[model samples]
Target: MSMFEKPSQAEQELKWAKIWFKQFSHFHKRGGKANWDFSPDDVILFLRSKRDQRMPAWKRMKILKGLLVYRRFEQELPIDPFSFIVEKMKEIVANERAKQDGYDTIEDVVGVIDPTEPDAIQQFRRALRKDGMRLQTERSYVGKVKAFMADRGLRCLADFASVRASDVEAHLTDLAVDGNVAASTQNTAFHGLLKFFTLVLKRDMGPIEAIRASKGKQVPTVMSTREVASVFEGLEGVHLTIAQLLYGCGMRISEAIRLRVKDIDFDNHLIEIHGAKGGKSRLVPLPDELVEPLQRFVESRRALHEHDIANGTASVWLPYALHRKYPSAHREFRWQYLFASHRLSRDPRTGERHRHHIHYETFPRHLKVAVDSAGIDKHVTSHTFRHCFATHLLWSGTDIRTVQELLGHSDVKTTMIYTHVMNRPGVRIVSPLDRLSEATGRQPAGKSYQEGRIAYAAG
Candidate 1:
């Protein structure tokens, strides 16, 4: 090509091909090869090496594109071995860019497939929703399935058909050995893939024999009554009420936030928690202290609901097909969220304007501020209140089974975790140092321990 003339597409491709070959030559040489001649297996191994080295997706795609152009136009190979690999690389690059742009959903990762085409992710999501999975759980399962597909370079729906139990075992083993992910995370990924294969793909995933991630025992953090009171002093208004509900009712943050007006039974003095973890419902005794304040809060919320109704935006979200079954139920005062968002927003799934609950982060942000103001040293979160609730109840001599029922834990063993942190008076054992001080008839002194012993001896 002349310097004055623009280079043709073929010429530019050849330049990139030269650059790709130079890198390939170095890789081949390191593997004890003496010549430029290479096979498809060699190329595949080279790409795997790059992946193991954590090369950026875009750079990997550029390298694969050069190789593809070289094989098609320069070498004139009868069959292109790199064509499928190049397309898969392009998909990987697209997914990386989408994630960087904060588009994490499976639909966003695999953009706009033809309606007639079989979409594994779309089928997976539909199956999950049909099974009445919670929104958070659905997202988690979808994300895990997407990660499995990305790991095996399965870009299209057809690629999923060829997936075997061995492939799943290898991916799970890699997560344990290479990624060092938590045991719960690995279990979630395993279940997600298992569901995809069995439910969505209608394939039997023969028993998987994969290396499992290591599990560690973690004790829940419990706050003393004094510390809990101090934290409450720093918090006021809606945040304080939410915190109290978490501690007093033994409700999870999600369960507390999703509370509708009808869930609270003032006449019966019970707070009905529906759709808690594991899709179970339970009734917890309403705290005597919260009754008056909650009544006042409810009155304020009623006024807000009326204001929204006057403005033609009093709609709240109803689960499943409730809106279709009871058209006017969403507009009723009893359906309103006890802690509704200040602003009305469009539901991403329905595209309808509704007043959803407050954002999950808002309460935690306020809790953090309160924790700082109260000078609490331990790590604190919204869930800490629930932990405190369980441990404090145990300390106050509540039966473990009763605590389990109130917390909505499915198993008594699951509720036993709080027992490890409870400071029960019946189980108190004196420290050895205190026992020694008692035996010596002298209290242990900070700097005057010897003087205290001498004084005790003289006495």
Candidate 2:
């Protein structure tokens, strides 16, 4: 069958009818269709007229789906995955029955300290997350806490810090041995557990890095300029524009996806990024190339906003009661999305269907398609654009400090990473090999600093 082929109504019915007939048929026998001639039209009508089912009925439907396949195989017809799905449904029903009978166990179901307690770990976890603690951090901390508690089999809050350094070491060793979790992964877990013991539980956990991690050997993946161009060119339509905003502005994918129309300042050519990373705001220079697209997007989005509002679907993000403060902001064109989703989305915090930014997964799907078309052999992801942005800027001789501001890095030390991308001797413009040669006084090894001084003077 062609990959994209849409099966005809008759062909579809025969396929499903055989399935239902098989479920009711005995496995050893000809499966009940032995007496009657098979017809596609009858099967189609049967499947179409099948009633909506509760879970138990759904299980029976799965059994029917399986039987159709078994008969098809006996007759040497084409094998479809739909038959496999029927068999899986049988397994699911069996598993569900066992669960109800308590023949099997589920993780995290009961017997942990009550999370509703004022200072319980789960309560803190919820509070920190609501207060905007990073998701990865929360996951890591929860994992570490669970591992530590489960090993000693301690469940009470009173057990905190009663476990010694050896217990922590044993846990880390077990993770390395049994779980095979990476050294870096273990370090993150350690840091999270350390934070809890030191900060929240008020314990004297001296030297948080006592169980230190080995140096990780991961290098950042970045696309070369030509590869980046090809990737963008292969992408059709406005997706390229969104990718450009991601790479060109050096913004995180989350920040770019969450952006609103009013965030753009055309007058000053600045893009305001609000509530980034730390519940703080920062602004970056908007490229001149993006202006026309932004304007076009704005006009189309305004028309959509009117339609959505009329349909009672335009629930805008005028956060913290700003909707009350500025009564008409929700209906305003400047407050709508520049690249809104094809479908309306509900806010996680508020259960309201408002037109929001495009979903994160959609862009990644587009990116994968673009990557295939571009013929990029390297594994590339959405965040690779951010890495490319930093590397490209560094390669172009932009100062580290400037790239740091654009990337929103709090530390200049973090910006030092791009020096590897440049392969140039860092800020001092001195290399380790040159230093070694100079130390030996071998052939006046290092290149002269005269041109740098002269170029510096010219600037």
Candidate 3:
């Protein structure tokens, strides 16, 4: 449509419904044969199928939001389906909150009923949790299996056992050829499926020749000093603080957000990073410039914690077995997140209402806005700051070993990617082309170029 033109109401409704359905697919996918041209009734049937699947309230809300427009215009139903789903979600949330507030007995906390393949997948998740997989790793593994099952029409654990090694291989091949997924994504899915089969389904996927994704050397994107400054110029407040930590402390966004009150030592000028990538801990030097601001930020966090305590909802998420051992630690000020979220949220896993840390997604959203507003052309993510941190440190003559330690990299080689990203592999040397151009007898050929016709040769 042109700028002056508007699409018909039906056209607009269908467009919006499609967008919502795509969003829904991110978290929920039909696990059986689904018609591509699904009607509103198909959507309703799918929702009804998930009644016992133990979906979080927030996710159900997203589904309802997606389907509301479709149900309103495209179909006539006996009841307002969207409103029903909305009320169901609200009830779940309220029940969860009530339980947290001691209004319900322990019996009120319910586990998955009428267990399906999804419930069986939860068993695998519990095993992963017991083995102490990082949250991101768990999500990736679970998501891959969910996507695979959805694609192959695997409705239950019985279907999982029947899947052959060839099936797994073909699925991965399709991800590369059909989905056009990135090499890393393909690798992740491949490994995730193998793991799900072995660990979750308790079946071996032996000797499969899957068409592997092309593995290319990946170098992290780094911003120049001027470009880095430009990103900061557009950001202020907590966003700026988080970005600064990403660049200054060589911390991942997850580590930075999960930083707790007790982790920072103002007197020692060190920040303790616990439960980082690979479940390792390390200390990084706190930037001299950020100390006072960090102190003030901590004060604000403490205030929030005090308010939460008074409101009887001060719990913060603790790493495995710690919360169980130290039940009161969740409510402690020292255990409070350094960058607490503005509002209290219910933990999807435990259904506990508490003030959690700032979500990992929030920083990236703000950083993208800042980077765009600053007119930086690079694809700057929260991680780009980390790349900048390492590269800048190396450029300023920091030893490789020290940089590795600061970066919480288990191996020095892992930290060595900065050398490639910095475009300074091995000892820095002037290019041969530049050297030749600098010679007295030779000027750069392209300095003054002219288009001239060449003489035609007779064959």
Best by lDDT: 1
Model 3 scores worst on lDDT over the 10 consecutive residues at 450-459
TM-score list, all predictions: 0.69, 0.56, 0.69
Q: Rank the candidates by TM-score, best first.
A: 1, 3, 2
- Pitting candidate 1 against candidate 3, the one with the higher lDDT is 1
Question: In candidate 1, how many Å is residue 62 off?
Answer: 52
For model 1, the local distance difference test gives 0.80
Query: Candidate 2: which stretches are off by over 4 Å?
Result: 1-122, 129-169, 182-184, 194-210, 317-337, 349-353, 422-459
Where does model 3 exceed 4 Å of error? 1-119, 421-459
Off by over 4 Å in 1: 1-118, 425-427, 436-459
Summarize candidate 3's per-residue lDDT along 1-459 as a digit string, tens digits: 221124475577567665666644443554322223345455555565555586654555556655665545544333353455555665565455445434443233332222444665776676554334566887898888888888899876777767887787788889878887888797778777767765566555765666666767887888888899988988889889989999999899989998999999999999999988777899999999889889999999888888887888778877644665677888889988899888989766566687888888988888889889988888889889989999988988889999998998888989888887534546567778879778866766665342222222321
Residue 236 miss distance in model 2 (angstroms): 2.4
Candidate 2, 1-459: lDDT as tens digits: 221124574467566756567633343244576544344444333433442334363545554554455446555554353444444544455455434434343221111434453344665464334333555566667677776777877776766647765576677767767777776777766666666664456453543223333556567888888999999987766678789888889888878877787898899999998767766678899899888887787778778887887887776666534565577777677777677887877654345567778777878899999999989989999888988899888887799999999988899988787767545334455678777777988654124477667789999
Question: Relative to the unseen true structure, what is the C-alpha lDDT of residue 204 in candidate 1, on a scale of 0 to 100?
Answer: 57
Deviation (Å) of 26 in candidate 2: 94
Q: Provide the overall lDDT of each model, using Cα atoms, as 2-decimal numbers.
A: 0.80, 0.66, 0.73
